[model samples]
Target: MVKRQAQHIQVDLQRQQLRLLSGDACIASYAISSARNGAGESRGSECTPRGLHSIRLKIGDGLPENSVFIGRRPTGEIYTPALAAADPGRDWILTRILWLSGLEPGRNRGGSVDSLRRFIYIHGTPDSEPMGQAASHGCIRMRNRELIELFERVRVGTVVEIRERC
Candidate 1:
């Protein structure tokens, strides 16, 4: 299958949705989970930072769906219901990962608001986790299959904008 180049991604924090766009066309839309703490621009706040960002890196290109990731590196364990049940409180990062870095200075890039330092990413979560709601530690979370489809359609340096509303 020929893949389409993604132009940009808009993340609506208020609605808990992520949209992939190409010019005026809406390529795909997926339910996403943002931060439980709402939106802010400070490290350690556990909040999703607002403003423009880009996919600095794309990890798990060929990794299996539900492949576990920690610190952007695969841990060799695939996510399963039993594993999730064992660690109910664990912040699960699964499948593909789209690591994001802020572009706007002070507001989201530098000092205490540096998104890269905050380890912000758009990644996958367990199938049991609910989407279209704020439930993540900081990163945006999507379903494994949906995330894989998105990951294949985008590349590093793709623009991402996170906002409180549409």
Candidate 2:
């Protein structure tokens, strides 16, 4: 049997959108929140790296919506407004997580610019948080339901290209 080509994701930093594409056609598009610090590839920069990347892992499968995750592990707490209120300063990683690794050697991968070392991800965010904006610390933030849907559709090794299209 021939292996199917993996679908690719295109993240437009300027538009704050993530599009899933198969071949040349767009399969899905979602409003997303990227880095408020903007795009870069340096460790400790807290900025989203711009380049070709791939899903290194997919987490939170079969988990309920609003499921809370900390350090890539489920925290056994579902996200609630009260919970959010209690930890207002916390950067919530909810529902699902799509961990990414940069494909480029120096631009976003390896050494000081390693995206995998940076722990970059496309993850779920609080419902109160707005999308289609640059608000995250460095990772891509999606709506909880939207992220679950996306997580179901994508697999590890899917290509993700993050770019700033002016």
Highest lDDT among the candidates is held by which one?
1
Off by over 4 Å in 2: 1-6
Q: Report the lDDT tens digits of candidate 2 across residue range 75-146.
A: 999999999989888889999999999889989889999999999999999888989889999999999888
TM-score of 1: 0.95
Record all residue pairs in model 1 with backbone atoms less than 3 Å apart, i.e. clashing.
none
Model 1, 66-143: lDDT tens digits are 999988999999998898889889999999889999989888898999999899999999999999999999999999
State how far residue 145 of model 2 sits from its true place (Å): 1.1
Predictions in order: lDDT: 0.92, 0.91
Error of 2 at 44 (Å): 0.8
